[model samples]
Target: MSNYTPTKFATALLLSVLLAACGGNDAPAPETPAAEAAGTAVEPTTAEPALDAVEGEPALADAPGGDPAPADPGAPAAAMPADAAGLVAGRDYEEIPGGKPLEPLNGKIEVVEVFNYVCPACAAFQPLVNSWKARLPADVRFTYVPAAFGPRWDPYVRAYYAAEAMGIAERTHDAVFNALHIERTLKGERGEDSPAEIGAFYAKHGVDAKQFASTMASFAVDSKYNRAKQFIVRSQANSTPTMIVNGKYRIKGTSFENMLENTSAMIARVRAQGSAAE
Candidate 1:
């Protein structure tokens, strides 16, 4: 057994190769079509569907933690409620009078985006809305308020905050979308690139590994979500991509640009009325 001829060595190598090939063949095929389809992550749609807020338009089929915001795609919001003062038609959404109430920015115009990472619609709105965000007047301070709606939403939201906590938002925010929508990677799906998977993605992009893990579980991140929740509950946002101009009006639109336009108008409208801070 210790001494072998060149031909014997060659024979042994061939046998080993054959055994490896057999092992490869023995592995089972992937999950079946139906099973895979159900498990497969949904690729984000290229174009957004026409959103009708009042006509009972179906809510997003998926919610992160709770029910989708109540939007009736059929019946438009009731004409801003008769008693609503200082609000405008198709302009300001909420109705709390007084020249643009103060915001978390310490009296600056507060524009908050209540968004979820898993929502295709929110992903679609980002590029267009981001442009307006970039152009927001100096007096304005915009904030991103990621929602924690359900189990599905947490991973994405956590990934976002985790990256931010690790100070890698600039690097990972867009990459996350590209990962999920463009590359068709199911980083969101459990077991693959789950939260830990996303965290790894961040680490690859230069995020501090320890920082990423701690940020994911940090109370500070939880506080951020809590603040977002309270903002919606108090403002009665009731919809994704909602904007509150100076806390007096809610602005929403079919597309991000339109929402931005309406938001700008609401801001000016409130500003013209005059600032009312205590």
Candidate 2:
């Protein structure tokens, strides 16, 4: 019998509530057609839709070995689908002022997804992100930036950089999520897991447990983790699963599917602009 209990469920629910609170508030419903027919004058209101999380940058270290390398600037851009056209700014997405990527573009369109392992929403979004990432064109580079929203979340941020530095991040990414949310082997926000425990979890993946724990607190990991936090601050992102495209556009959508569609379109747009500049 599984030992999973409401504590995990409650933790996720609480974090979700926090995510909703920090991100944009739910937009007020527009006047319904029935209300209009009733001759009630409804004032127009403008508000941004709620994002997944919002809490709110620098050249990040090179991605772990598993990520696809950035595409050549001269490489052809992917075809822009019809659905990508006419996306409303501030409605479908928001433009970041003086935005920049976490890493030097070096001619590739960059996409950074801000996430935290403790974020229930991010865990839910991972499978979708993976599928979308697999289809990306050669000119696009996707990176994951973990957020340490609080003390409880900070260790995982350290762990992520440590794992990345060790080149085990790619293989261990999903497993970490599963361990916390599915397998219940690792406590997330409910009860903190020590560095040694986390390292032990990665041991199953073939890394030296003690070395992994040491790396979690190493200077390299510290630098990378801080850089990620800086980039998140620069991007003005406060939520999990937030996607920034080329550091120019912050993707927003009514739903996850919409977010992905907007991201694909934005990638195409950036690629087209780059092609034009040449």
Candidate 3:
């Protein structure tokens, strides 16, 4: 909700992200790590784009009344499974973003995006993110792991989590991405993206000042960040916007076009046998 978007990995978290992985199926219930694990540790989804529309920009929009939105022009994102009921049957695997040990992805198509605010790649992927998001069916669950690849990425995460806490994400989520990615402003001269400064940005977006402050400093937000850390470690990814389908499959941007198609196909294939055990 804050004007600044947080990076996937913070500088201090790099070593922690590369730490030990929880090996056993500690929690269990079917497909995704959460359902199969004796319980579930489902993470957050791709952020809602902050909604600042120009006269002519392709958008990531949801069905206002229940209509499927337009598909991205670049390429098909992760596709639905061949058999709608077979989504859970895809091959099971876990990936670590940047291949640095992060957390353990149990099953399911675990799509974790490791983003840094300053990264051009993340920005380039922003416009198309909405289109890709709309197509996901029930069989798949997605998560966003804010990464502070370095000092530059830290503030963005702080702002991201803060907005989540304040419940202003719906209003300011896409705005922050657009501001940083599309606009390409934000020189970050004097740590202007700091929590306090970012809070101001959220206020400008229409979030109340008191709520924004509370959300930024809340224990819940910190806990959310902690969970994200676990996801980062399990995926072993080293960059932003990386997709780990079913933990076992790794998909990058070049492959992303096909990645979505294959993932959807895989999900449908798996889900057909039986429903995901929740």
Candidate 4:
């Protein structure tokens, strides 16, 4: 973690975002009529400690590899069903101010998932997001931004960046979620795992222990973490599994499935705008 401490203003801003997010006390009521209407199961809210653990064991580093290549962006977008029409802005999604730009700006619309590895809601939403990503058109790009809510959450974010730097993120991303939610090996509470222990988890996935440790602390990983944190703040993403389309709209589906449906519509919406602009 950067020795850099959050300033009072930054901390206040993050707290405000968190309080406004789903995990907060004022979070939306589960099993709302909208969710039932969408035929979606509501995820239960639990009052566990704020911290969650990372999953996996560390192993010796093998040969270095390149970053995971972007998925093919040329496929045609899937069509939205008739029922997916009229997704309202405030109800179904919210628009961001001064929209964020796509990273690497590959001339395609971007979809960003701001999530945390330790969030149970995020874990539950992963498969759905994965399926949605698979169907994305060639003109759309998808990426994940791990949230850093506090010190307890910092290590997992570091782990994500480390794996990315070592080129193992694509292969091991789901495994980390399984470790936390299924295997129950990684804990989220403070002081559960040292940097070395966390490094061991990645090492088990073929990330060299020493190299993983070095990379986790390296300037490169730090830069990525900083960027992710900024994105979360700028996007005002207070909840896990939050989806942003072209960095202009924040999607809010009544149900998990509905969220994906809304995501599809937003992508189409953005694609149309891009075409019109050209």
Candidate 5:
């Protein structure tokens, strides 16, 4: 009886291990869930700041926990969102040292998103971005900066610049996202895509496929590529879908919704600072 008991216990443990092993996967599922597709996750009731803290700053902290910090006394009172008061530095956002706008300010508050086409996170963030940007005031400038972190990511950066060169970037942006994340046509993730193949996708949007492919490696596209790399390096943005506000603050929100809210608050902060200077 004692010997049987030991064997039964060992068998039970083996069965549990087998079940866990069968459930695990080294590869991504063929399809992402709808919530993840939208890039939304069930956030905790008590939110904490992200660990992507600023460089040279103390290690990422869980401070200012439970609720956001109160509104900055220096933030402009007018044109600010109600939640702006809850913004806490190092948690909601971080100041970039010696940061400069990727483009000339030209009297506009610049907000740039450093993203990658192969990034599932960026794909999920797109819908939210579309909605948020639509509500932006005329004085605010929103820019999309595609990240070329490696060979797999670089082709899409080229594709973006090439499309922009042909004046088809805005028109084809959503289509590109759909092709990659929703339709699963482009092989950006597998690093199996080429300029010609990607150009073929853009061709459906009225671009000449051959010209599009050629432009991917054009001198102009190369220039944009180099500048983007430099700007990302200097900003210390190591993740896709990172939001930089007025080239001064890098947002690190607790969730997708929180990110947009923080961006709005930062915008107000910049506007207020501008007014004070005047």
Candidate 6:
């Protein structure tokens, strides 16, 4: 695990990556001529806080852990009906070559969401993801990985790590989203909030501001944040609100609702495999 210490050079590199990812400010770009002609608004791929991609270029194949294993030829059949709703590997999801969850699961299947608090799409998807998570069986484990695309997003990532360390992540997670998206009190753009400012926000939810600030800069938080970056890279999830199931498959769907449905099917498939193994 790399201990994160912000050097002038590293900070500058991160900021450069951020600028490249967004092309500029946080506003959503206007639809292109082709998109308008097609009668569909072209959702900005990296425009605005929520729509932006991760920092640095995508390097999924070179990520640590190597490539994910090939699909098991003798694998048990998926439990879901092989109908339209059924997830088709490579079509609805891609297997990670060396993809594995951040933490080992003693026996439970792992489901992870790679997201950013500043992302508008993530804010929109939060309630849906939350509802799905609440209904997960005990045999399935769910966790979140906050995206650290650049210096602008570093504070939010630090805030998340600090909250998790303080055991207040769950309590304050939704509140953070609401603060950014609903209330519009917290600006999602980079450089909008200092560590001190973010600490004050957490203080409202019972976290000590001073401790939060200290923790955000601690070696432990840095390690966690670094691990999160690796996970995002390995998952090959370029956009916000992407899901990975069992660290093996990156779920894909035409729409948000489709993605959730696909996720449910994938969870069922993994559960079935575990049961069969037993």
Candidate 4 per-residue lDDT, tens place, 38-68, comes to 2366532222222222222122233488898
Candidate 2 global TM-score = 0.70
Which residue pairs clash in candidate 2? Answer: 53-238, 53-239, 54-238, 54-239, 55-238, 56-237, 56-238, 57-230, 57-231
Q: Residue by residue across 155-240, what tens digits does model 5's lDDT show? A: 99989989989999887776676666545688665447888898889988897999999999999999998777767766767666
Residue 197, model 2, lDDT: 95
Best by lDDT: 2
Per-residue lDDT over 85-191 for candidate 3, one digit per residue giving the tens place of the 0 to 100 score:
22322322223223421334343434455654444445444444556767787546665567655555666776678876666665665666555533434433123
lDDT of each structure?
0.52, 0.70, 0.47, 0.64, 0.69, 0.68
Ordered by lDDT, highest first, the candidates read 2, 5, 6, 4, 1, 3
The sequence of per-residue lDDT tens digits that candidate 1 reaches over residues 37-90 is: 121232212222222222322233223677678888898657543222344565
Positional deviation of residue 149's Cα in model 5 after best superposition, in angstroms: 1.7
User: Which residue pairs overlap in candidate 6's backbone?
Assistant: 50-119, 50-120, 67-97, 67-98, 68-96, 68-97, 68-98
What's the distance in Å from true for residue 54, model 1?
A: 26
Per-candidate RMSD, Å: 16.3, 14.2, 18.8, 16.6, 14.2, 11.7
Number of the top-ranking candidate, with TM-score as the measure? 5
| TM-score between model 3 and native | 0.55
Candidate 5 segments exceeding 4 Å error: 1-85, 275-278
Q: Rank the candidates by TM-score, best first.
A: 5, 6, 2, 4, 1, 3
TM-score of candidate 6 versus the correct structure, residues matched by position: 0.71
Task: Count clashing residue pairs per candidate.
Answer: 22, 9, 67, 19, 1, 7
Give the CA lDDT, 0 to 100, for residue 108 in model 4. 80
Model 5: number of backbone collisions: 1
Q: Report the Cα lDDT for candidate 5.
A: 0.69
